[model samples]
Target: MKNIEPKIKKLTADILKDYGQGRTIDKMNAFTSPDMDVVVDILDKLQKILFPGYYRNKNYHFYTAENNLQTLIEDVLFNLTKQISMYLRYLPEYSNADYRTGMERAQEIAMEFLSRIPKIRDLVETSVQAEFDGDPAAFNKDEIIFCYPGMYAIMVFRLAHEFYDLGVPMLPRIMSEYAHGKTGIDIHPGATIGRFFFIDHGTGIVVGETTVIGDNVKVYQGVTIGALSTRGGQNLRSKKRHPTIEDNVTIYSGASILGGETVIGHDSVIGGNTFITMSVPPGSNVSIKSQELHISSKGRPDAEAKDLDQSATWFYTI
Candidate 1:
C-alpha cells in the first residue's frame, strides 16, 4: 500500500509537469477570444452605414441624421485606426519604427476608407439589385441585403480590400477571414473584385491574392480560383500569383481554375467539375467528361470475375 501510494504520487506529479509543458495552454492563448472581432464590429458598423434604413434601426430624426452619422463615423475611425495600429505592432513584416508610424498612417487610411463609403454604398446597392434579379426565389432586395450570407461576405471583403490597398497589415486579412469563416467564401484581402459580383451557394470557393475579378461575375460552390504555385516566391515576394477573371463570367461548381497568368475571357461559361490551368477563350464553355473504362481478362475467369462482369457489380461514372 505504501509503495503504491508513492508510485501514484509520482505519476500525478509527472502528469502535472507534462500538462504545464504541453501546447494546450499555448493553443488556448492563440485561439481564445480572438481580437479580430474588433475588426468584425467595425465592418458591421460599415454595413449599417452602407444600408442605413435597411440595416440598423431607423430611429434617427431629421435633425439627428447628420450628427448621428458623423458621431458613428468618428467612433468607427478611432476604433479601427487603434486596432490597425495594434495589429501593426504584432506584424513581423514591419519594423518598430514602422509600427509607431502605422498609427498616424492608419488614421489617414481610415479617413480615406470612410470617404469612399458613398461609392461603396452605391456598389452594394447595385449588388443588392443584382441579387434580387439573379435569384428567382428571392422575395426582394431587402431580404438579400439583410439575410443572404453571400452579400454579407462580399460586403466584408470589399471593405477589407480597401484597407488592404491602403497597406494596413493583418487587420484586412482578419476581417476577410472572419467573413470566410462565416460564409465559406474565401476571398483574399488583396483580390480586386468589382461591383455587382455574386457568389451563389458559396462553399469551398478560394479566390487567391492578386486575383482580379471584373463586374457582374457569378461564382458557384466548390469553385477554386487559385494560384498554380508559389515556387517563384523562393526569390520573389511581390510577383503576381493568381488568375484574372473578366466580366460576366459564370464559374460553375467544383471547377478549379489555377495559374498566375491564366486570364479567363469575358462572357465565358465554365462548366461544373472542370479542372483548368490554362486560359479559356472568350464566350467558351469549359467542361470535363467522365472517361469510360473496360475490364477484361485473358486468364481463366473465376467466380469473382463472373461476379464483377455483371452490370450491377460495375461502378458507374457520374
Candidate 2:
C-alpha cells in the first residue's frame, strides 16, 4: 500500500501543476473562480424572496416571516457578493488587488442589485401576467407563476439581466444557464427583452445573445431567434447576430428567425415551422402553405395517412 501510495501521490501532484498550460489553475487561488453551486443556491433564495407566499414553509409561524426573510436576504447577499468577487478576480482588472479591495466593488454591485429587487419583482409580475393572458390553459397569475416554464425562465433572465447590465461577468451566464437547464428555455442574459414578454410551452426555445424583443411579444416552444451565420467566429463578438422581435408579435412553435438584419415588425403573426432569414415588415401575417403532411393511424405506426388536402390550410387572423 505504501509503495503504490507514493506513486499515485506523485502523479496527482504533477497533474495539479499548471505545466505552462493555461487550462490548469493553482489550488491556492481556487477561491478566485466562481462557485456554480453557490450561485444556484443564490437563485433559489432569490426565488422565495421574489415571490413571498408562494414558497412558504408551514413550519414557520406568520410572525417569523419577516425575520426569516431578513436572514435569507443577508445570507444570499453575502454568498452572492463572494462569488461575484471571485468572478471579478478572473479578469486582469481585478487580479492585482487584495481580497478586501477586490470585494469592495462586488459589495457595491451587490447592494445596487439588491436595491433593484422591487423593480425586478414588478417586471417579473408583468411577465407572469403576460403568460396568464397568453395561455388558455393557465387558470390564474398564481398558476402561471407556479407552473409555467416560461415564467420561471423569464424570472431568472430578469435577475441575470440585472447582473449583466451591471457589467458583472460570468455570474450572469451562470444564472442564465441554470434556468436553461431547468426550464429548457435558453434566454441569454445579454438579450434585451422588454416588459410583458412571454414564451408559451417554452421547451426547446433558443433566444440568442443579440436578440432584441419588444413588449407584448409571445413565442411558442421550439422557437429560435438566432444568427444567419457563425463562420465569422469570435470576430462577431458583441456584433448584432440574432433577429429583432418587435412589439405585438406572435411567433409559433418550431419557427426559426435568423440574422441580425432580420426584424419581425410590430403586429406580426409568424406561423409554426416557419424558417425566416430576411426582415419582415410591420403587420405582416407570415405562414407557409402547400407543405406536405403525413399522419399515422391511431396506435399504428406502420399505417400512414396520405398527404394533407391541398385546399385545406390553417390560418390565423392577426
The C-alpha lDDT values of all candidates are 0.76, 0.83
TM, every model: 0.77, 0.83
Q: Indicate the worst ten consecutive residues by lDDT in candidate 1.
A: 292-301
**Which pairs in model 2 have colliding backbones?**
none
What residue runs in model 2 are displaced by over 4 Å at the alpha carbon? 1-29, 57-64, 291-318
For model 1, what is the error of residue 150's alpha carbon versus the real structure, in angstroms, after optimal superposition?
A: 1.2
Clashes of each: 0, 0
lDDT of 1 by residue, 137-233 (tens): 8998778977888888888887888878877778888888889889898999899888889888788899998889999999988999998877766
Flag clash pairs in model 1.
Answer: none
TM-score of 1: 0.77
Each prediction's RMSD over C-alphas, in Å, is 11.7, 8.8
